[model samples]
Target: MAWGITKKITSAVKKSAKGKATTASASALMAQREEARRTLLKAKGTWSQYDGHLVRGRQFLADVVEQKKTAHTDGTHTQADGELVDIDAYSHAFDDTPNRYSASVLELFLVQKGLMENSQGETYRGPYHFNSATAVVTGNPAQSAAVQDMMEVLKNNEGAEGGSRNHASAMTIEDMRKVMAWSYKQCPDELISLIYSRVQSESALDMDNVILAQKHLVIRAFATTGFTIWTRNFELTKIRRKDIVWNCQGCPPYDIPYDLLQDHEYEIYPQQQTPEICMFTHLRAWVNFLEEVLLRRPLEPDEFIFARVGANSVVYASDQLSYDGVMKMLAWMCKEVGLTARYTTHCFRRGGARYRFMFTPLGQRWSLATIRWWGAWAEGESKNHRDALCPIPREGDKSFNGDHILTAPITAAETQELKMSFDHELNCLSGKVEEVLDKLTLAPASSTYSSPLPAPSQPPILVSSPQSLQPTLCHQATISPFLESASTPSMIPSPVPVDSTSSPSPPAFPTTRALPSSSRQHGTTAKKAAPIPGVGIPDLPRGPEAWRTAVKQWEDPAASIGGKALKDWPEEWYTGPMRTITGVKRNIRKVIAMEFYRLQRDEAIFVEAYPEATCGVKPLFDAVQRQREGRSEITRRATYITLSRPAVAGTTFPGPTRALAQLYLFIRRHSVLVH
Candidate 1:
């Protein structure tokens, strides 16, 4: 009976222990699920904030379309009509909405998905869509075709046709020039006031001038640096006059600052800074505009460069101008000028990049490395190594060495010269008009007096003025003393003096004059004359005497082609194969010249050593050509190997040195052939 009672108690104890464990496990599982739910809710809230802005952007676009339709029906939709709506409404909806996220979020979207951001954090904005359809209808026909072509490219849904809804349209040089010309003609005062405000503020305080100034600043920045609208609108701080270089710092990948609170925990990281040199002229303009017009004087290092200019000429210092403001200003300018091409803020960046790549000379071209750095492209390990090795934009460098791909900002000196030229041309035209009027006033009002004055004996000189100085829409010829200063001797041939007895003849068109084969300039030798076109290669030297001459020529610096220094030969001879030669210590040209001389002296010895060269002069020449083609590359590889070797004196030979040693041994083996 005691054993049965003990068995029952044991069973009850086992059940209680099992039930306690089960209850604990259920509670833990429920806690985990609740935590997951909270995390998901947080993420959803963040995304909802972003999605809310996008939805508002879509609604704004719809509203604009409706407004345009209404304007059309009322017959009030004209190009000059800037009063479509108040700027505040658009600004509030797109830029300053409470639901909007930070600028970094917009940048992230752009980088990851190719979705372009406007004042609002949305891809499709009103001005871009509206202007894309309507802007091209009113300008030049050729321009109209170009615009259509670009629009078609943007509109094409096929990936093979180089079209994408995500990609922005690019403007060509001709397109920019046309837009500038049209803008200048339509609103010269406004444009001038805008640029003028950069230097002199008191004269440019008018509301139109302030608005135009803001627009001009954006245009100049785009044309000069290919800055994205986000970078231009949000990233520019109160840049000092001395601060020519800009450094972007923030999150990895895109390098833009993000709000740590809203971002995922994993995404919150330290800032990484990357530096870019600003164009000199553009920097100058920006500094001046910021200090003089914006009145951001004694500029704080972190102060924003752009500000808001409100109605009644009120300037707001607290707020930064939104991407919407820039878009609206540009849209209004296009409409006012009747620009035929569709343009958006992104067009400037795309156009600038395309222009630099296509039109510039090889020496002035931006390498892939430079472009990647400037554009803040996706970084990799290889790119990081290359960036470390490159020596461009060295410290204390103040100017772009010689790059002219970016439209050079009009310097004060250049602007003054243009103005003077225009004045001189104007004076000449005025004088001619006055003379004609005087002649008419003096003549009798009779049929015989109607006869035209005897034509001038000499053909009138047609001076070519700078394009900037020329009158818009009207082409005219003028004679001015300023033309003498403007004309280059190489471009315009001196006029032959006409004899009094000789019949009048038409003026000769200017022809390019060939420079002398050898000349002195500024106490130095001038550049060498180019080889005559269509000329075949000259016969090379032969025998002992020829060998001596070749050696002497190689030793003499003046004998080098184009007077290039011995140290500069590697770069000068750089071809596709020569890129392998990273750092050559000696003169490669001299080495090649010496080899050529040795081969010329003993052909059989060279042929025996290098059997692939075969027999005859053709094969010999071919071998030399091959060596010349690869010499730079070989030298570079050799240098790299030498540098990489462990520090032990005379323990290892560089690749090029080793090759040279082998060649020496071969020549010694065939010494008997030389004698």
Candidate 2:
């Protein structure tokens, strides 16, 4: 019995030793894999991890080689080159070592803040790494006391948000509206014909610049597409060729025959047939451009889509589209469009999310659940985090359809008009103006489309006269300039959004849609009396003489053409993307109104003239407060009972859109109580 027991014990010891050896070998292999992964990630380069942690979770790829979405071993991250990276080591660089990081949470904050501060002073050459806390930069030790100090700092930041960088300002609906309008207004030539008219016209001789301009258009295409689909920059960078499911149902009937996307697999995520910034539309066009135009045909299954397109339109398939590269294009485009914010790639995620939640037409806006699923945010994630991303305005920021909730109180009757205005704006948000979009948005993309009262060449019933500019507002016979053009009800046309395909070429189109003409000093007007054939929202239609003056004004501002009345002034202003954008139209009108207000103020005729409109002693109360927030979105729905020829200044706003002439007066007189 004793001998049998000894034999069993010896066998168990041997088995245990073998199992321990196997475990040891497996751990060693994992370590080896981890080191290899880090080498690859470093070589490929990191942007989100370094760019102020712009995209969440990307910067946390230190402990795990490839950052995972959940607390699991199966990492979700992959390099742009489609390499798998799942290792339990931070071997990215010696600088990436967690020595300083583990010291305290403060170290992480210090790293980001330090890098941001440094990058601002010097031109950023590449992805920056956080250095260990040196004598120059100190870090509090990782202790309870240190953590408490950090909490205090966070509370202080929360308390003082005006000057705090604790939160990033997400793209508001107004910003999106303006940005999209600008994108479409600028990219029409490039989007449709794959060319930049303005750039080519300006730098026709400079082939290099022309090519670079074309390349920027391609970037614009990608930016617009990604924003519509709510895609992260990382996801966009690594979009596999296989995932490009092309559903070319309503694609422009391009007669140029090509196998477009021969054997491309289907993707269920990207929708089809939808008009507004359809992801499939952009992607299919990109693929078609590559296959038909550039002859970069037959995209491989594992290949990245946005590969670098070189000077000769050469598709460098080997080079993947990096985050930094996309950012450079975005930065240039943003500046060109006059966006003041320094938006990072995360803005796309934030912008789309906010648009869906706050800006999508009233009842049609996405619910919190849909937003969570669409944005890849966990259902149970911190409400604060989601709020930060899709910030709901509070106190002074609260607005609806560009009107302050308290100051510019919308009436029940005007509520439907406001809803319709948004519906129109959202319908043509992409500015496509295609048949599908036209059916969807109640607006046309083409120039031949109809608007009952065609956009005027200048503001009808012009109020200003360069000097004095004091105008009669409450006259019975001079109310023609405040009426919303028939079809527009206050909104204009749908703009055709911009697009590019990572290709270098030039696009031509001058995107300047300020309120033109009617200002006698520094403005020119178009001259056409036979009903201009483009979408416009003039207060009233202009006559032959008005049209003639506009034509002379536009053709020769110096009176070189002797104020000649030609058949038409020019089609560019009336037909460009700027005309479609509601914001641009509003902005131009705002400029004109502000100009009139300036002159009126100079003449000291504001309060004295607006006796009935002024709310008691607080002269021009609502105007100052209401215009303070969303002044551009001021409504033109104010009652202008008589739509007759002007008794004073001018007639049929063919010069400047006089749609807001009454609103300016209303601003001066109405003393709206804040809700």
Candidate 3:
């Protein structure tokens, strides 16, 4: 009957899982259909102003030309009128005066100031008045000839020079490399973490590194898709999968505008970034991170794409990020990446165009016509538009050698060499930063604990393993002085010697999330695992009598995980270094839960929220007292055999003719020690 009930529960769980899958699949289908609808709108070329003809009068009146040229008295843009202005206009001024009356006092001022006038020396012949105090544009062009000429000129110039650059500077692969280097710097991890002495470029991070990945994911997507789309910065801000209103501004292309991608929908990083700098990979990663991991739910249509993320993780996706905010970040990236060219949002369009026109391999290069259309340039727009955005580099001396990057495709070997060199530079710089930060955060600690080099007299300090040192009752009596900066000198567990023949220490349980287990130790190819101390847990139930002593550790594993109240710990633990430490005395409870591991030299910190989480030497000896107070030999022997220090004193069960459990335990300990 019990088995049958268990099966029924299992069936219900499976059905629930099936229901969830169905819901997710439906979301995906809805998103796909929404994307299809958007694609149709883009193909039609005026999605924002759909059915706008109906909004204006559908009937063709005698003054149809005037009706079309001028906006409605209610202030609305027509479909054709919206098309006449550049699509980028939606980002800046969605509402504006009718195109016919667009010649404003401000326009006259700018034109008079030499900022807005045509460089070809053409003037607006239409009526306008400019005095020193104020300027006014002509309201009514009663003379039909001047209006027609002005209208024709305006029509010819729409979207012609909107995103064009004067001194065109394309972002080369080297520039992208710098941006990527900057991205790695932003992401604190084994890859570019200050803590690690060496970093591996080729080594991939697990998709499960949710917190670590999210911090960098925002900036990475900004850099990657920012280049790939070649869109305006404001358009880049519209990269929401589920954004409602402006989703159809232009294509990044069209996955995000309707709603976020559903659960299990997007790929993780390193899966696609084989070159260590891939646009598609980072873009997908950023989107996926928002939905599946950071938010832990599909984003609403109104959510921010790059939510307020910090060094830790996403803070919120509440507010719409402004273009000025984005531009400010772009400015920072330009400065930090060491690009001499002051890049605006226009650089993305310009740089991408240059790659298509000149840098791409000859046979695969984009045609001038395709480039024009791809960039939303209108018909009859020629080579000069692309040339202005993506001009060939000319030497100071006007030598043709300046265009060498355009003529020659870099060999794969050269690219790889460059990547490795960047990796080396990243490691050196990040490693130094880690050192400085370690010193900065640990600055409050006394000099004795903050010292870098271990005194020559002391034994080489093993970080976690007290078994490696025979003299300790604790897991580790002291960390190396450099690692000690994270904590004050007092919290270091004072030694309380245990019987040499006593039980082995339990493996340290980390407050921080566990890194992927690695064969590589510190200062190796892989990332260094956070310096977790090998501390013994309070209640292992040394004897059968001790089992029912309200040792509620296994009852709720997480309760003890953060650390039980200081009152709950053995009285002996209240003695020694723990008693002396002011930090431990202040806290009521020990909470070992860490949002993220610290980036410093090798050491585990008894951080805020969990001051006394670090297992001290006195606690180990206190636990041993449980073994000596056995009610019977059966319980006593069991306790001794179960927790016995395996390497030196293997489980003393039936001696030479050992129990299978004892032999297995013996073998396991040997294997651990060997590693």
Candidate 4:
């Protein structure tokens, strides 16, 4: 009986130990779950404001739609002709009504329905689709004219006399600046002041100031970055206050680190983390805007940065601004600024690209590859898939590998050179415009001055008698200042003194001097010719009519003095031929180098025959030709026949191939002989 009691006691002890182990394991599991929750919450703190705003905005939108439906069923609301009202029009009505919550709610609805369309009738489904459209429209005639002229200049081959001809359309840095200036000028004064204020100040915002503060942030971000409306919206909706880096995720259940829970106030230098991605100052502005303005109160990870404040002063969370709404705002600004050019969201991207290309330091410039990567353009596996759907011949072959090969960073020296070049061009254009303006301003003075006619081909000889006078061959027209400067006595030398013996000497007239006639001449004296009226210094045309006449005279070869034909002078005298020659030489050298390289690939024959051709393949052909010159007479004769055989047989290759084949055969023959 005692042994049985001891066994029972041992069994009881073992049961208790097992139970204790189980309890410990359960406690550890719960503790891990709590830790995980805390880490997630810490990461959530970043995007919490944006997510809350988005959620509230969406909920409010649904409520509005439901309320409308309820009112309609209750006969409290009625439609005119039962027509479907445009959501954009309905949303715009609230702009001046002080119903900020209603406006935001409608915006969320429009965003969800994808009902926003720009002036071009192109639909903007999401924020990313919003591009340069905001800055595209320009109504100012002078600016528009300037932009058109710039476009023409960029698309044409420049002529010697500052004329241009149509070619392919291209954009330039000047064109981009024109557009940007228009946009900048068109922006509201209040918004501009707000942006400037935010950039200058470092003060934190109070809860009461949050609404106005966030608005300022949004404006500042958009103005500084030249980011597409959608990109800004996407970032604002997804980014968190403590999130130092934009991971390119639109919105998130983000990947958070466990250590983040320990230090809630930790921040990182965006410039150090993503040096080449975003501009430093712009990134700082963005971070400050988020922390000091939008995140003044508690927020959820999935909320939007912007929120709606109702007429009753109730603040509601809101989603992003509608693409269409932003476009309409841009259009309003364009109209206000008197800009007439058709602009869209794409303008921002183009302008930004041009700004970076022209103004940024060489080392800071972003390459095409970087743009494609950062912009989420199709590339790598995705690019392959896209290409397969619409295949382009040799598309894959055209792709370059590595950032270094694709684009080089701009250097400080290069930036300075570019700046100087751009400044010079701008100054030249400005000078021309100023000249035109000055002429217009002094219209009365121009009308009073009589324009001089085009000078005669040869100075008219005033005969002693009226019967001896000859009629002028060319008509007299007004001379332009340009023509007056161009036509000088140096252009046409005085006629060689006529042989006095062969020609009869005429009687001297007024203003004429006596010339020494040849002793064998008939008893008469040849007279020195007087200077012709308007020969060297012609009076410039001033008025509009005179200007038109001058232009006509300048263009017409028949009207010009000295019997010089217009066809003799090419439109592009100085630079055209030089460019053509440079291009031809470059192409020829490239072809020759390629052929020589190909020949050298035959290691056995190339090394044995042209041992001295180790430096480069280009010198190999010259060495072979030199060796051939020293060859026996018979061998030279044989080579000539062999080289001529292909052409004689009508089987010689054309272009670079023909040249390569001839060289290859000649080199092969010499190599065989040497071997």
lDDT of each: 0.40, 0.42, 0.42, 0.37
Residue 35 local lDDT, model 2? 57
Residue range 1-675, candidate 1, lDDT tens digits? 334545654785699866753355888768855655555445757767877868766465456546666656653443343545332233333444543323433444454434333333443422333256655333234345567788777556556564434454676666655655543443343344434543443432445555555556545543433332113323442322233333323423334432121111111122121111223234345546656655646445444444565764354545665667767766775676566566665666566566545654333356666556444463552433122112232212333432342335756665665566655654564454332222211112332212112222333233221212322221111222222233342232224578989974432222122222222132342344332221111122433243233344445554332234433444434322222221121223334344655577465665465454434333343345346435431211111112211221111122223333222322233333323
Report the candidate with higher TM-score, 2 versus 3: 2
> What tens-digit string does per-residue lDDT give for candidate 2 at 555-612?
3333311122122324443343334332233223333234335445442354343332
lDDT score for candidate 2 against the true structure: 0.42
Count clashing pairs, candidate 3. Answer: 4
Q: Runs in model 1 with CA error above 4 Å?
A: 1-166, 186-206, 227-279, 293-298, 337-346, 361-363, 378-675
lDDT of 4 by residue, 1-675 (tens): 334545654776699866753355888768855655555445656557756666755565556656676555542443455645444334334343645346545655666556443333433222222237685433434345566788777657465365553332222334434434443343333333343344346533233334443443454444333432113332433443333334322111222221110111111213332222223344455445554434445445544433333433243444444566455544654565455554455544554555444555454565555445434452452332111101111233544322243355766776676667655654564454332222111111222221111123333322121222332121212221222232211221223467758973321111121222221254433453332211111122323233222333334444322123222323232123322222222222322233334466465554566664454423443454344335421122111213322121111221222333333433332332222
The reply for model 3, stretches above 4 Å from the true place, is 1-169, 186-215, 243-277, 292-294, 307-318, 361-364, 369-373, 378-675
| Shift in Å, residue 240, candidate 4 | 5.7
Off by over 4 Å in 2: 1-159, 166-169, 190-213, 248-280, 294-302, 311-313, 367-369, 376-419, 422-675
Mind sharing the TM-score for model 2? 0.35
RMSD from true fold, candidate 1: 37.3
Worst 10 residues of 2 by lDDT: 434-443
**Winner on TM-score (3 vs 4):** 3
